[model samples]
Target chain A: MTTTDPSSTTPPPDRRPGGRTARTRAKVLDAVIAQLGEHGFDGLTTDTVAARAGVHRTTVYRRWGDVGGLLADVLDAAGDDDWIPPDTGSLEGDLCGLNEEIQTALTAQPPVMMALIASSFRSEPAADAQQRLWEDRYTRCGIIIDRAVKRGELPPGTNARQLLVTATAPVYHQLVLLRTPVDPELPSRAARTAALAASAGAFTEG
Target chain B: MTTTDPSSTTPPPDRRPGGRTARTRAKVLDAVIAQLGEHGFDGLTTDTVAARAGVHRTTVYRRWGDVGGLLADVLDAAGDDDWIPPDTGSLEGDLCGLNEEIQTALTAQPPVMMALIASSFRSEPAADAQQRLWEDRYTRCGIIIDRAVKRGELPPGTNARQLLVTATAPVYHQLVLLRTPVDPELPSRAARTAALAASAGAFTEG
Candidate 1:
């Protein structure tokens, strides 16, 4: 319907009610990821995504608005997944598990994760969406530190966000920033380092 | 001269042996940084850079080839600076100094450093040059760890690259990747965490 015009719509129904609308959104977003993975942000366009999603170009335009909107929605959809933090009994183990997942996502074939990160630099909408996703992830991972404090593996008053950032920053630095060859030991080593620092109350809040 | 044609030249003389050549290189590269800071990668162009540097378009095209080559040269020039790591007596202090420098570069008014990082994602040549620049900085900063070992602040055999990465990644991770607001304490806190972790032999090589 012409009522679906994004200019007139207040919220711009990305999650429109009804099975058909839901399916269209899912298909469009899925296509966005696939296109980003395969062609990168430079090659992505509403026309390409619409063709790949088997949807009308006008529909794609009305819904997503632009490439930035498409990229933002893809990241927003990612945060909707039920991604619970690992519970490996110890903080070190939990961090190691988390690091492994990060490593895998970063090194995935077609480099979708890295593409999204790169896209965020070019798109304001994607950057904002990514910030939300990161905040959501940080909040979710706070439980890892909570569990560790309960297990007496870490001291009370440890700042979970600080410790988590310390533990995970190395992977992103090494793999993404430096573009270094992957070191299999990096994940566990970084986790151990952060875990040790946390035990010493280095991340404890005032 | 026709001899300066990039196709005929095997080495592509970015640093030709003459005061004029040096001056031109300096002017152009400086212009590249200024343009990148002012307009970002999206707005950067060979024509705009040439105009900014007061150089002819033909000369800019002959030397730089394209935006990618221009970006690569800008990064390469950064590695030529005589940047010695801070010798702040203690490892934590040295790391704090290093982190503070990183924070400033990342949060500069025009955000030139961050723009270079964002450009690397879109340009293959820029990415390669950035990798080399990172390697050079890491190697140069190794002296900080060596002095720490000698001063008994950290254990012998502590991995300098690993320790430096641990100390510095948080700043980049927070400022660049997550786009978090600058926390003035982050530099020292991260440095202290990394120094403590190194004292515990977490980064010691096998």
Candidate 2:
């Protein structure tokens, strides 16, 4: 599988997976998300992560510099930009494409996602990165809507920006904010809902 | 001033607010929200909150039983059940009404709101309570859209639940997930947009 390129230009810990540094980073990052899911922003600490990961305290501190850096790395790793925009010649078909992407993501691992959200309040870098992630996601989203706007399937002056956001925001609330998992069917439903919403006049063009 | 009525057979702690016990409870609750805003779930501690609030650490431990319990109390304290149904006599009024309520609550204390979001991931009681909070908000939302469904402004077989959620999900995303604050006017604009979307046919009853 092709791996997501880390947005952080930080050199990979000069070691292969299963090697000492790789194993250590993996252990610590995993532990951080786990502890964050269990604890919260104010509850997370390097000590707890190290203990959970079974790594030496020095090793944890040395690699990431501090908890903030560690969290930044975790969020970076978590933001898998593997989504492929759907081109189904219709808004409904395109949304199904996007939902499938999110479903794949939610199924793979929620640890980093849980941590990024948990710590977003306290960490400025995390906040910035988190916003950037959305900007990227929405930028991708507009591509699908742009087609409808072009085809006159949607209103002439539809606010593609709001349409893009309105389309994806539900899956987010459903998966991360709400406790219940999004139904396997929810993605397709969401896509159609978004497409229909867009067609119904969800935006205002400048 | 007239106090909120407690005659509804609910627990005592919720009904009243004032003595040293009330003050202590409020401070501890405030501290947890503030600390969580500054800290994340895994970083929280009873010690820190007690120190921050100038209450005895033992008092905090005694009242809440633990950090989890403290989070519950904090969540409870944040609630205001003055749910007002929108009555502009149109679907547009209802949508704007729902949007305005959420914007007010979120901007009331941004840090606290962020802290609550982060904390819910770690604490089950916090998450459940938060879910109820969303339900409270959603229920009010449903009231608005149901009016529209009755008015025939929407298509027959409209799913008010899905429609209402799709309407405001972007507002939440703008503030919470995207970290971009919504403009004050955007709420009203969004409401209109959503109302139109509903009219033009965005959702179907499941």
- Give lDDT tens digits, candidate 2, residues B38-136: 765656799999999999999988778777888877766655647566788988877777788777766664466766776776678888878777766
lDDT of 1 at A173: 92
The DockQ value obtained for model 2 is: 0.44
- Residues A103-137, candidate 2: write the lDDT tens digits: 66654454445556656656777777667666777
Model 1 pairs whose backbones collide: none
Give the DockQ-based CAPRI class for model 2: acceptable
TM-scores of chain A across candidates: 0.91, 0.64
Q: What is candidate 1's lDDT per residue for B150-177, written digit by digit as tens?
A: 9888888888999999999999999989
RMSD of each: 6.0, 7.3
lDDT by candidate, in order shown: 0.92, 0.72
| lDDT at position A114, candidate 2 | 54
Q: Candidate 2's error at A77, in angstroms?
A: 5.7
